[model samples]
Target: MQNMWKCMEDLDQYLTYVGGPAGALALTGVAAASAFYLASRPSPEAPLVPLDGQSILQNKDTPSGPEMIRVSKFYKEAKNGKFLSYFHEDTKTLYEGFRRGAKESNNGPCIGWREGPGKPYIWANYNETLLRAKNFGSGLVAHGLSPGTQTFVGIYAQNCPEWVITEQAVYCHSMVLVPLYDTLGPDSCSFIINQADISIVVCEDDKKANLLLDKSPKSLRKLVVVKEVRPATYQRAKNRGVDIVKFTDVELLGAQKDYPQTPPKAQDLCTVCYTSGTTGNPKGVMLTHENVMAALCSVMAQLGPHKPNKTDVLLSFLPLAHMLERCCENAVYMVGGAVGFFGGDIKNLADDMRALRPTVFPAVPRLLNRLFDRAQQEISGSCLKRTLFNMAMSAKESELKRGIVRKNSLWDKLVFRKIQEGMGGRLRLMVVGSAPLAGNVLTFARCALGCLIVEGYGQTECTAPVTLTVQGDHVPEHVGPPVPCNHIKLVDVPEMEYYATQGQGEICVKGSNVFKGYYKDPEKTRETIDSEGWHHTGDVGQWLPNGTLKIIDRRKHIFKLSQGEYIVPEKIENIYIRSQYVEQVFVYGESLKSCIVAIVVPDVDVVKCWALENKIPGTLSVLCNNPEVKQLILQDMVAWGKEAGLSSFEQIKDIYLHPDPFSVQNGLLTPTFKSKRPQIKSYFKPQLEDMYKILM
Candidate 1:
C-alpha cells in the first residue's frame, strides 16, 4: 500500500507536468488536494445489493413516503380484477407486451405530426413505425442474429421512424444496438462501428451506406439501407460487390414472425452508446437488458415518475441516439402511450411540440435552457405577462423551497398558460437531464408550466440513469439520492481526491444492472471494475449531511489553489454558464497558477437580444459576428465568471471569447456536450497565448 501510494503520487505529478503547458499551473491544485486528502476521513463500503441506501438514509432522518414509486403499474390499463400492463390484453410482460399492442394498433386511427418546418418532433409513434419495427426485429433475428450476437448494429439515420424502429427491433431481438448520431461525421461514425464489431448495418441514407462500404471491414456480414437523400449512394454501396442492400430488401427476405421471441432476459446485453472520453478510441459502454429496466425502477423509486397511459403522449425530439430519449422510448412503449416525433431539425422543434400536444417529455439541459431563454424573451416582449410571471415565479419558488407544489392560480391563466399549451396541454412532466440545468431554468419551468420538471444524472456507461429526483421530492442542491436498486458508494482514495467525502474518494457502484463490461476489451473491463465488482466511475462525489450525494466534478478535472482549496472547474463553469448570454464555457488552469480562465461562446438567440436592443441586427447568425456583441460578451464573462464561481481560483484570469459556437461539424464539441478539450485548446492555442500574456 505504501509503495502503491508512492507510485500514484509520482504519476500524479507527472500528469500535472504533461497535461500541457497549462499543466504547470496545476501545481497549487495538487498540493491543496494532497493536504485535503490527508485531512478527510476513511470511506465506508458501499451498501450491498440487499441494502437500500434510501431506506438507510430516511430511517436516519425523518422517513419519506413510500419506499418505491412504480411506473410499472402506470404501463397498464385498469381492468376487472387484474390491470393490463401498458399494452394490449394479450401481452405478457412489460418488455414485449407494449410493443405488441402498438403493432396491433398500427394504422388503426394512429396519428403522426409535426405542424411546420423548424418544428422538432414531427412523427414519434405513427402506425407505420410500430408495424415496421415488429417486422424489422423478426427480419434481423431470422438471420440467426440476437443481441450480443455481434458486437453492434449501427443505426445511422436521421430523426425518423426508421431510427426508432431499428433501435427497438435491435433491442427486441437482443443485439447490441449502437445508434450513431447523424451529426457525427463519417470518420467518427465508421470508427465506432468498427470498434464495436458491428455485424448488421442499418444505414439510413445513401451517403452513410457509401461511407460504410468504403471503410467497413469484410467481416460485416449484412448491410441494410433505410431512408436516404441520394439514390446514387445506394448504387455505390451495391457496386462495391461486397455485401449490402436496402432495408426494404432485408424485410422481403425475413417474412415469418415468431414475435416477441424470448423477450430479452434481464441479464442480456441491451445497447452500447459509445461516449467521448479523454480519448484513445471511444469506449463501447456495455449496458444490460436489466440495466435499462432498472432505470424504470429507479425512476419509480423517485417522486412523481412518468405516468404511462393510453391517453398519455410523449414528444420524441431529443436525439434518439441519446440514452435519456431511448429509455423514454422504452418506458413510453411499455405504457402504450403515443409518441409524437419532432422534426429532425431543432429550429422546427417548437412548432412540433405545439402540434403534438404531447403529455410527456424527456429533454436535455440544452433544450430546457433554450426553453427558459424563450420564456424569458416572451415575457420581456409582453409587459402584462412579464409582471404576472415575475410575481408568480417568486411565490412558486417559496412553495418549492418547502417541497410543496402550490395549486395553480389565476396568474398562470393570465400569464404563462400559453407556454404550457405550446408544450402540449397534456404535458404532465418534462424530465431534464444530460447535464446540470440552470437553477433559473428549473424555477421558470415549475412556475410557468406548473408541470413536474425533474433532473437526473447518468452517463452512457450506466445506460443513462443512476440518480434522479422524483417530482415531489425535488431537491435543488443535490441531484438526488441513488435510485432504488442502485448501489452508489463513494470510495475513499487517500491520494487522488476531489470530493471531500466530506471523506470518500471515488464514486463506485456494484449492481446486476451494471453493464456486462466494455465490448471486446477485457483489459479495459478489469481496469474499470475491481476484484470486488465495483465499477470505479472517475467522478468525484461526497455525501451531504442529509445523505444525498453531491458530485463535485470529474476527479481528473479538479484542481486547487495556494490555500489548499480544490477548485472544481466544471462546477464553476456550470455556474458561469447560467448567464443568459453565455451558451457554453470551457475552464482552463490545471496546475500552473492561481486563477481560472475561460473560453466563452454566446448563445445565438441571446446575442440577438442585444442586436434588437441596439436596433442594429440582421439575423441571429449575422449578429454573432458583430464586433460590438463580441466586446459586450468579453466584459460580461469577466464579471459573470468571477461572481458565479466565487473568487481566488474561480476568477477568470483572462478569457477568449469567440463569435462561433462549438459544434461537431466545426470540430469543437463532441456529440455529447463535452468540449473536445485537446481539440479546442489546440484550435485556440494562439488565443491562449494572448490570454496568458495579458494575464501575466
Candidate 2:
C-alpha cells in the first residue's frame, strides 16, 4: 500500500515536470510505455449486468400496446403494495426536509457564494441558513404577505445563495415559489404574475425590480430586492403604488418578532414553474411537495452507491429557474451536501470550478458539447500529444467496455491528468439532462474525465427526470429504464408511422413525480395529462433491445412538406450539428414547399481554420456570405446526414450560413438552451425566403 502511494506521488510529480520545456521529450517515452502497459493488462472481471429494469404487460385487451417499464425495485415494491415516496418519512415538506438536513449535517456547510472574482467562497452553515429562512418567512408575514399554500411568492434572480434562501423562506410559510427569468420575456412575466396572483416578488437587484415595476401587474404590491435598491427605482415603484424594500431589511424586521412556522402538507403546491412555450404563453407547472420529494427519491435510487453525501459539493451554475437545476440543488440539500453558486457571469465558470472543486456536477448537453470540442481542439494541436491522447482514450474505453471505471490508472496520470485538472480534479459523477447528448460526446467525456457520466431524460412536467442511465451502464445511446418514481410506456403515433408494438412511439410517464397540472388551465392540463394519468410527452422514443429508452424524434416539431412527407426538423438538426463546421442549426420546411432549407451558425474557430487552410481570407460575417464557405458547410452537413441514414427529403436542399448563434438573449433559445423553433424561423424569415428562391 505504501509503495502504491509513493508511486502515485511520483507519477504526479513527473506529470507536473513534463509541463516544462526540458522534460517534454522524456514525457513522450513515459506516455508510450504507460499506454502499452494499460493495453497489456489482463482481461477485466466479467461485466456487471445492467440493472436497468423489466417490462411488464399492463393491458390484456390491447395486444399491440407496449408493456410498461419499471425498475426492478420499483416493480417489486408495487407488487408488495409499498412504494418509495419521500426521502424521509418525517420530512414531508421542504421546511421539514431542510430542518432534518440541518440536524443530520450537524451545522455543516449548506450554501455558499463568492464575494467577488478573486475571493474565496463564503459559506452559510445549515443552522444559519435555516434560521435565516425562518426570519425571512416571518418578514414576509410582517409585510402583509399572506402565509399559506394559496399565496404565491415570486423570485426573479440568477443562481445565488439568496435564491435558495428565498425558496426555503417561501416553503417555511407554506407559500408557492414562482421563479422568473429574463429569457421568459416581459409579457410572459406579466401573464404569470397576473395568473398566479403573486403579491410579492424577490428581485436580485434594482434592475430586476424596475423590470417588475414597469410591468405594473395588479397582484404585485411589493418588491424585495436582494441587493441595494436605487432611489430612482424605489420612486418608480412608489409611483406604481408598489412598496419597495431591501431583502436584509425584511430579515431584520422579522428578527425583532417571532412567527410560528406554517409547514406545508404533502400534497400542497410547492412551486409554480412556468414553461418556456415554443408558440403560446408560458404555462405554469404546479409541482407539489410530494412530486418533488418523489423526484429526490428517484434520483437517489438511480445513483445507488454513488448518491451524494454531506461531503459532496455541487457547483450550481445552471439557471435555477429551470426545474433540472432546481431539483439538482434540492437533491444536494436533501443530503446535507454543500452547494456553491457560480459568479453571475458564465465566462468565469472555470474560475468558480477551480475555487469550489465540486465533487458532483449537474450539466446540460450544450455545456458538455463545448467541453468536448475544447478537448478535441487541445488534443489536435500537435502530433505527439494527439497520438498519446488517442492511445490513452482507447485504453480507457476498453476498460469502460468491461464495466470498470478507474481514475488513477497509468494512462490517467501520463495523458488525461490535465483534462481532469481542468474540471477541478475532483468530479466523481456528472449528470447530464435538459437535452439529448450525442453518443460520441458522452463516450469521449467518460474516457477523458475518468468518471461516471449519467444521461437523464425528462421535462419540467416530470420534475426533471423520467429516466437516468445507471452506473456501470456503458451503452451511451440509451437513457436507461424508467426511474423508480415513475413507470413509462410508449403510445402509437400513426401520422409518424411509430407504434408501441414496434417499440417506437411517444413516451408517456405516470407516477408521483409527475406534476399536478397546469396551474389554472384545465384544458391544457387535460391535453397534456390524459384521463388515465399518463403525461404524454411529445418526444418520440424507441425501446432498445437492452430495455433502455432512446429519444428518436419530436411530434410537435414535425411539419408536412407539400410532397406529403413529414419532416422532423429537430431530428435533422441533431444530425447536421454533428458536423465540425456547424455550431447551431435550424431546419425549416414549409407546407407549400417540397424541399427543406437550413440556417446554420458555423463554428467560428473551425471555419476560420478551414479558411486559413484554403487561403481564403474573410471575417466571420463576411465568410457567412461567401458562396464557397456556404458550399463547404453544406457538403459537410450532407455527409453527416448520409452517415446518420437520413432520408433524401430529410436532408437540407439549400443552406444559409448565419454569423450569430441562437441564444437566449436573442430570444431564439430557452433558458435551458433549447432552440425556440418558431422564434428562430421568424428571426430568419428573409434568409429562409432567399434560400428557397435561389433553390427554385
Each candidate: RMSD: 17.7, 11.9
Each candidate: what lDDT? 0.58, 0.78
Give candidate 2 regions above 4 Å deviation.
Answer: 1-75, 79-83, 558-696
Tens digits of lDDT, candidate 2, 658-679: 8988999999999999988868
lDDT of 1 by residue, 1-696 (tens): 011111221222222211111101223443453344335423322222221233233232432342211111111211111211112234333345445546644533233555456444334454466566667777787765764435467776655666666766665666667877543445566778667766677766666676667775554656777654356654555565545566775555554654564455556676776654433455677776667766654464354334555566777765676677777766666555667666554444555666677777886554444456555655565555555556557655655654454324444444456666666656777776665655666777776676777777666666676666654544564566565545566665654434333434577765534677887778998998889777788777666554556666565665533221246667667777877788888887632233567788778777777778899857655665576776677667667666653544456766666767889988987889677776787888888777767764
Best by lDDT: 2
Please identify model 1 stretches exceeding 4 Å from their true place.
1-131, 141-148, 211-214, 228-231, 242-244, 256-263, 304-306, 377-386, 402-408, 495-504, 558-696
lDDT score for residue 359 of model 1 = 73
lDDT of 1: 0.58
**What total of clashing residue pairs does each candidate reach?**
41, 0
TM-score, every prediction = 0.65, 0.78
